[model samples]
Every structure is written in structure tokens, then in C-alpha cells.
Target: MPGTTPDPRSPHRGRAVRGMFASIAPRYDRLNRLLSMGLDQRWRAALVRSLPELVPGQRVLDLCAGTGDVAQALHGALPSGTVLHASDFCEEMLKRTPAKFEPGAAPRLTVGDAMALPYADQGFQAISVAFGLRNIESPQVGLAEMARVLAPGGRLLILEFSRPERKIFSAFYRFYFFRILPLMGRLLSGSEIDAYRYLPESVWAFPSPAEIGREMEQVGLVVREQRRFLMGAVVLHVADRVAR
Candidate 1:
């Protein structure tokens, strides 16, 4: 299970996804700030604040750690002696991580896949993955792997786009997300591909918070909280690995 790759026959599959991220790696952070109108920063900040306090020697893993934003935030929040590790399948994205996040006490960075994490069972005390679950080849497999690497009672935080509950706002948000945002991202990132286009489609296809909660439960993670921001356009799902 740890080494399994996504189905090759799936259209716009994992390889395409990886290429798209690599193509847009340089402008990814800028587009995030611009497209989200800086709310992305606040969302991540809230997640950092919500994490269980870390003791010295504790380990936190930031999976799908694009550009190291969450990793940087966790590093800042954790005490000096705790270990912070960040991993991403896209080496380009990992390379683009700003040096400011990894000063003297740098977080260990690894190029890894979420569906097949290369860690022992219960290896981490806290794990966070932001805005990248939708890109995984199999979100269920990814979720299960998150449960696998987490210690008993460990925290798991997932930040991702979600459907708005309100009807009128949902319609408008869909228009902007499917049409306007893609155009803007295409122009800014200067990528001929459909990275921006794929983003909304993936998010739209992603399971709702409730469904995700059930999947987490199936993987032995208890849903501790589900917080919606920007009127449910974004969701932060927090869970705890159940002690066996």
C-alpha cells in the first residue's frame, strides 16, 4: 500500500498534476496571495493556533507541504527543540520554499507522496496538510496514510476548498472559481497548461466536509472539529488518531 501509485488510465492524472504544479511553482505563492485576497494566510494562521502544543522532541509532519507555508507557520508556533518536517511530491514546489522559513533550525524537507508516506506507524504527534489533498491521486488513500503515520491521539489538520452552504453565494462563488479565477491564474502563472482550471474542478469534485469526516472515521481518526471560513468556501477539518 505504501508504494502504490495512482491509476495510469485516469485522465489528467497524477503525472499531469505533478507537471502542472512544477510549471507553476515559481508563481504559486503569489497566485495564492492574489487569488485568495490574502485570506489564505489567515486560514493557515488559524490552523497553527489550533494545533495542540508541542513538547520538546515532538515531531510534526506537514504533508503536501507546498512552498513550506504551513511548515514555516508550525516552526514558528512550536518550541525550539521540537522537530518540524515538510514533504511534497513536487520537488519544484519544495525548492521554492522561502529561506526565511528555514533559518538556523531548518525543517527537514522530503520529496514524498501523500498516498504512500515513507514513515513508520505512529511516527508523528501532529500532521497538517493544506490545500493539497484534492491534488492527490486518491484522497481516501491519502487520508488513510495520514491516519497511519499519526501517533495515538495525534492531531491531523486538513485545510482545503469546500462548497459553500448558502445557495446564492455558492452559485456566485462557482462562477468566479470556474471562470474568473482560472483566467487570472493562467495569465499570472504564465503556464500554457490548465493548472488553474484543474484547481476548481478538483475542489468541486472533492467530498464534502461531512463525507470527509466519515472517511476519516473509517481510517480510525475521530473528527474533532470542522471549521468553515469565507462562508464555507474553505474548510479546516481537524481529527485525532484514536488510541488502539
Candidate 2:
């Protein structure tokens, strides 16, 4: 059903989302590049660029890391002594992350739920989620969890899909997002679950950037900056954990 908002607390919704990603795991990276016209990586790079400088031995977490694209990018950008962690609930998607690196070079990969992350409090100096927050069963719970693990003054970056402000461009983008993109996804990934169809629907149902910023503030994070790409079709939110 078009315009239907997902019920985040539904148990069935979690299982369905997990199943959808697992089914598309094989061609996930390929489909992303094709569907986004290779702009995804650039968007991630922008996220990385927004990070605050870190001292040696400080840690970073890439939550809901599918195939470790953001983790790999962070690995290259971080100081030599810094550690990086990559986590996702789907093992099938996470298992592919190591192949993107040489022996012993990949970020520590963990199969864990975003809402109930398996980590200690104040553990990470920085955290990032790329196009994954909206997929969480409860994005607010996920944000709180992220805040719990973040050190005071730690930064969090969120790269996600957003609606364009320009009316004419938004209409064209919606036509492609809701209609054409899913067709390409089904053709390319051969996914029976219609994962790509879920993509636009999720985006449409997601909160606006300002709303998300307010949510962050409620969870002990302060919005620092927001950078939009693809003419507001995508947005990167930069925030910091409030010092306790």
C-alpha cells in the first residue's frame, strides 16, 4: 500500500526487514551503485569528511554496517592507532565485509541488533549510520542506544534519504524513487521480497531532518551540522553527544 507508514514496534516488521536484507545480500552493493548512479560512495565520503579529529586509541563504530563501506572508508581516514567497529544484525550481509580488506585489516565485525547493541557504555568516540537508521524497528530506541555507547563529546553521523525541497525536482525524484528504482532493483537483484520497493516507502515514511535532529537532542545528542546531497534527496546529519 502506497503512503503506508511502517509500524516500528511490530515484531513482524523486524522479521520482514531482516528477511528482505538477507535475501538481497548477494547483490546489495551492486544494486546500490546501479540504483544511486554511483553517488552512494560520494555521499559516504561526505559523512567521513564531517568527522571531528580523533586522538590515538579512540574508537569509532559504524552501526548497521552493510558490507562495511563506511567502515572501510573510516579505516582509511582514521589515525593509524584508532580502532573501528562495524556491526549489523544480518550475518549474511556482515560476512561480506572482510573481503573488502586484506588479511587482518578489516574493522571488527559483529552481528548485533541496532536497538540492543552489544557494547559497553561510553565506548565509542564517534559513530555513523549510512542509510540504515530508518530500517531499525524503533529508530528512537536505536538513537538512544547509539547515545548510550557514545563518549561525552563523541560525534555521530547519519547519512540518509530525504525529500527534496524543490517541488519540481521532488516530483521527478519521487517518480523515479517510487516507480523506476524498484523495477531496476527487482530486475538486477532478482529479490522476491521487493526490497527496493521498501526503500522509497521507508524514505517517504521517515521523519524529516529537523525532526530527526530533535530526536537526537532528546537522546542526549546535539545537532552540529547537516549536509545535503543530490539536491536534498540525501542528507548527512552531524551531531555530538552532550557532555554529562
Candidate 3:
């Protein structure tokens, strides 16, 4: 099972994913910066910018908020009174979030599962997940929970790794992604877990943007827009919660 891809529906998938992330927690931020050549930050900013205009005191949640990068961006972009929350199932990853912000400026960090978020219904005006959805045990269940917590008309911005469409570029992308990236990740993070190897596998296994849009619709969210970057190697899906 050294190179085996994790099945999202496997009963043990969540535990496996959590452990993998936990092992990489310390180097997660650094690895992200290196792996994406800092484009990850720009992608996260795009996700924040895609949010619909939110009123003061409205809430936003950054689900699967690894090290609170997106949550920090949300805090800076939102109005003064907006409440921002960052949640991740892996406590180790959440533990590193506070250092990213000045004393109290950090988004409220919570250790919670995406599939069964702790918040009440319709609580968030917006929710963002950056490159995290593919790690979920069941992305549909995760999206449903996101929809459940989103206030009517609230938006959900998903920035995730997507396949490149151009033939030549895609071949090069795969060579780097599958062959080079994982080796670099393993060497740089010094993690025993196959976290880097898992990355490409998860992204490759993830649903296409069109399929994801349909999944969003099934969960009461309407796809509003999609923007592709890095020659479609990454995508931002902007969706809104439909009133019941």
C-alpha cells in the first residue's frame, strides 16, 4: 500500500487523512509556499475576493483551514465587525494558526470535522476552503455540511487543485506533480507519512469542476462562477446557498 491511493469512502479514510496531515503540520505552511512557488497565496486571495458582499457582523468560516492562511486573508478582507472562524479536524494544524496573526486578530480557531461541523444551521455568511476539500472522506457530505451552515444567499468559495486541460502543459504538470512534487515534499517536510504522494493522488481522483458544480446543486448551492488558474491546474468555484 505504499503508493496506494486512499479511497474516500473507506471507513478508515478520515483517520488516515487526519494522521497524514498531523504529521506534516509543522512544515505545512512552508511546504505550501515552496510547492506552489507562492502562487498558493494568490489563489487564497482570489477565494476571499470572490465572496459576495457581506454585511457587518456576518460570519464566515474557513473550513479545512490548514494553518489559517485563508482565514487570515478573510480577517483582513472582511469588514470590522465580521466574525471569522477557522476549523480543521487535525488539532496539530490548527495549533499553528494563532502565530500567523497579531494577538487577537486571528480568526476563532475550532477543532471540528467538516462532515459534521459543530456550528448550527445557516450560521455563516460565507465559507472558504482552500485546497482542502479533496482530503475529506466524502466531499459530497462535506459540501452538504457547508451548505447547511451557510446563510441563505451566502457564498462558498472553493479553491482546489484541478487538472490542466491543455495537452502539453498537462503532461508537464503531471510530471512535476506526480514525480517531482512528492519527492520534494518528502525531503523538505521530513515526514514519514506519504503526505506529498497523497496530494497528487487526491487531486487526480477529485471530481471535475462540472461534476463538482452538480454536486453543489444537489446540496442546495447554485454555482455562480468558476475561475481557473495555472492553466486550469487550479480552480476557484464560487457558489451560493439557495433559500429552502
TM-score, one value per model: 0.93, 0.95, 0.95
Candidate 3 lDDT, 1-244, residue by residue in tens: 2223345546458888887788888889989999999999999988888888888889999999988888888888898888889999999899898998999898888999999999999999999999888888889999999999999989999999989999999999999999999899879886777788888888888899999999999999999998999999999999999866
Model 1, position 236, has a per-residue lDDT of: 93
Q: What do the candidate models score in CA lDDT, each in turn?
A: 0.85, 0.89, 0.88
* Distance from true location, Cα of 203 in model 1, Å: 1.0
Task: Report the Cα RMSD per candidate.
Answer: 4.1, 3.1, 2.2
Clashing pairs in 1: none
**Tens-digit lDDT string for candidate 1 (1-244):** 0122223335447777777778888888889999999999999998898798678888999999988888888878998788988999999899766574545666888898888998999989999999988788888899999998999989999999988999999999999999999899878987777677777877777889999999999999999899999899999999999876
Return the candidate ranking by TM-score, descending: 3, 2, 1
Displacement of the residue 119 alpha carbon in candidate 1, Å: 1.0
Runs of candidate 1 with Cα error greater than 4 angstroms are: 1-12
Q: Per-residue lDDT for 1-244 in model 2, tens only?
A: 1123234445447767777788888899998998999999999999999888899999999999988889988888999899999999988799999999889999998999999999999999999999999999889999999999999989999999988889999999999999999898878876677887888888888899999999999998999988888789999999999877
> How do all the candidates rank in terms of lDDT, highest first?
2, 3, 1
In model 1, what lDDT does residue 182 have?
88
Candidate 2 weakest ten by summed lDDT? 1-10
